[model samples]
Target: MSVINKMLQDLEQRQPAQVTASNNSKVPAAASRRSPMYIGMVLLLLLVLLVGFWFSKNQQLQAEPANATNPDAAVRAEPRQPAPKQSEQHSTDQAAPAAIIAALDTTNTAANALSESTTASAVAAPAENAAVNLAAIITAEPAKPTEPTAPAPLVVVAAEEAALSAVARPQASVDKQPLSVAARQHNMQLRANASEAAGDTSAAIVIWQQIVALQPAEAEGYLNLARLWLKQQQIVTASQVLLQARQNGVVNAEINMQLAQLAVRQGQWQQALEFLSDQFELAAEPEYFGFKATVLQQLEQHAAALGWYQRLQQLQPEQGRWSLGAAVASEQLGQPLQAHQYYLHAWQYRQALSVSSHNFIQQRLKATEP
Candidate 1:
């Protein structure tokens, strides 16, 4: 009975010890499970940090190569701080794991602050690098040179004018050549005509003299000069000019007719007949025939005057003056019957005669009746 009671007491004390031991064993098991979960979280955090660091480093490396390739970009880039020494980098890497561990061991709020700080640093570092690269690229480009200004409008116009003047100088000089003989004579003739029209007889005479001097063979110049001299009642000058024209071998009919008229005006009837005799080719002309008939009558050459007046009467049958002239010439030559016939013919055209001529013809018809 004593042995059985002692065993029961020991079992009771052992049972209490066993319960405390089991409780101790359960605490170790819970602690072990929680440790593995904490280790996985720590490992995940470390992986994230390593990935962030690697991405930032990759961006930095890319930027460095680009900057090296372009000297201008490198020059424009913000001056970079010197790279850390190998030992310093190594020490920093070693300290990073310790800092992460410390953050994990701290309160949750402290760990969260550490994570936010790390994230902000990672984001800011890339942004700063990108800003630096953009600045370098923008500043490295070359500045464009300014364009040259154009010449002023006034200056360009002046240069053009100068060029045109240079081209035209020779042409203007060419146009200044002397006029030809015919052209000069024609211009002088026009000036003479203008002076004559303006009643400037002396100026017209001077111009005509210049024309005659220029071309002495031109009959028109001598004729115009003689006409102007006669207008001023310069009979001797006109006769001299006409005689000079004849001496110069001018065969003008007007010259002979003008000399005949001048001799008749001076009462030199025989001289008028002699002067008219040179133009025998003008026998067909009524003015020449009539003037020759009148000169023969004045010189008392009745037979010659009768022939000319009868020929003139035939040529101009409607003229009463020609019939009267024929009658006078026939009466002078003692042909009374022919004179009476011409007087009757003259009376037939009485309306063509002047009042004085009609009275004379009436008296001649009565006196010369057949």
Candidate 2:
């Protein structure tokens, strides 16, 4: 190569390189003379890039957990709060919940407590949980189940039915007979009564008629014979014999009661009322109202019957049976509203009686009531 050619190539390369350096130096000088606003923009861009890098690094640190195990845990498990003192515990100010809501809340609380306790125990004792299977768990849980408390024991009683029976011990009852005038007369009377009871009313009449003729002053014989005939459904004969006996002597009130019952049986209501005029001497009592009302009913005087029953009830307000009986009679007479009022009164008395008595009469009255 010629010395001149080599020098010329080298000069060309050096000139190009020196021109690039001069250009770069001019660019720096131009940049130094830039506006303050443009410089501030560049600085803002640098700050944004640095802030982005810092935020990314913080996110990575937050994702990483302090403890490797139990990553979802919020904090270290703290000891449970101790039971509050009675005074320290606050009473709820709200009104009591409705029965249904109270029951649901109680059930939910119990279920939640049971579930939480089971989870806590499982976490606390892993080896024990593995050792104890379903059978063991069931057996252990039975000792302290979170089931709702049982309701108070039911209070009910079976009421025993009361026994009702009548025992007879009449002083007039005699098994043996004696051979005497009085005994013979009694035997004859007894035979007549037996005949009447056996449906042989005509034979009984004949025996009584003979006895009356034999002893005209014997009022008892005549009256007893009249009663026997009455019992035999011989109403006419009974009335005639009783009329004859009335002249024998003034009979006692007990005999009059018998005559009254006989008259009522024969549908002679007015006569019966008259016969019972002297009944006060035998037995004067409020219970007689029942008999009076019954007589009135038989006489087809339903209103009077109702009045008598009402009077009895008014006299003894606690007599639920009588009150109900009166109500029934009123209803039969087509007085529905009046009967209902009476029934209501009866129910009131029955309630009072139920509270007062160990042996309630309401059950008996219920069967007989309207």
Candidate 3:
């Protein structure tokens, strides 16, 4: 019984030691599993912390620009200017081109009106302020150049008016010779007219003489100078100047008529007839025909005299003298019947004839009727 007991005790002690050893081995395996789990948990916590910090920093960075822009946006908005929309900016950009296109299309009146309105607005708003504010939105426009509100001083207004008148007045009275001969002549004429208006007849005469010197072929200058001489009662001087003008190929009807009158005064009837004959078609005066008829009748040219008398009567239909002259011419041409008819017509307009003409016409009418 003692031996059996000793062996059992020994077995029991060995069993206990073996069990403790197994427990120690199991503890090492469990420690390995627990360490891997702890490492994974710590790595997960670090990744979560890093992700949260990165997210917070990114949010702060994004919010800073917005916070900074707020005050600037408020300031920009204070001017009552609406922020330009993308669509409106594009429309404004197109407005200038549209105005140019409308201006080019002259046939389209409505388009032209629209273009005018658009141009006015563009000039007032965008074109004027474009250099100042690139982001400005176009709106209503001003129409014309701005005028000063307060009335200017009378002296200042008068000065401005005088300046304007000076600018607007013709520069013809200046003594400066223009490059063009025609311009010089015109200026000289204006100067002469001014001198004449100022009662400086001698100055006018001198200027006209200069004009005649510059343009010897110009008839008006000679005529003006001759008329000035005539106005001064210098008939001899007028006659010489007119003759010079005629020799210079300045043969106007008025100059010829003056020459004819002077010749008549000097009793050069033939020379007067020569002057008047050349101007018959050119002149439309009653005295020219009358003078021609009187000269022809005095020279015993009854046939030619009759035609002139007829023309004078046609021109002066209300006068009775031409009828009596026509009757006398017809009687000399041996047409007593025609003379009697003209004599009757002359008697009907006896008031237009002198008393001596009326008595002569009545005696001619009585003799022709018999």
Per TM-score, the best of the predicted structures is 1
The clash count of every prediction, one per candidate, is 0, 0, 0
The best candidate by lDDT is 1
Query: For model 1, how does the per-residue alpha-carbon lDDT over 57-128 read when each residue is reduced to its tens digit?
Result: 665675565566666655554354235633564465556655655664555577568667766766775676
Best of the two (2, 3) by lDDT: 3
Q: For candidate 3, list the clashing residue pairs, or say none.
A: none
Looking at candidate 2, what is the lDDT of residue 35? Answer: 28
Q: Please, what is the whole-model Cα lDDT of each candidate in the order they appear?
A: 0.74, 0.55, 0.67
TM-scores, one per candidate? 0.56, 0.32, 0.42
TM-score of 3: 0.42
Q: How does model 3 fare in lDDT?
A: 0.67
For candidate 2, the 10 contiguous residues with the lowest summed lDDT are: 91-100
Better candidate number, 1 or 3, judged by lDDT? 1
For residue 274, give model 2's deviation from the true position in Å: 3.1
Model 1 — TM-score against the truth?
Answer: 0.56
Tens-place lDDT digits, model 2, residues 153-235? 32221121111111222323453455786777788889887987898978987887777776777777677777777667787
Instruction: Give the local distance difference test score of model 1.
Output: 0.74
- Angstrom error at residue 59, model 3: 58
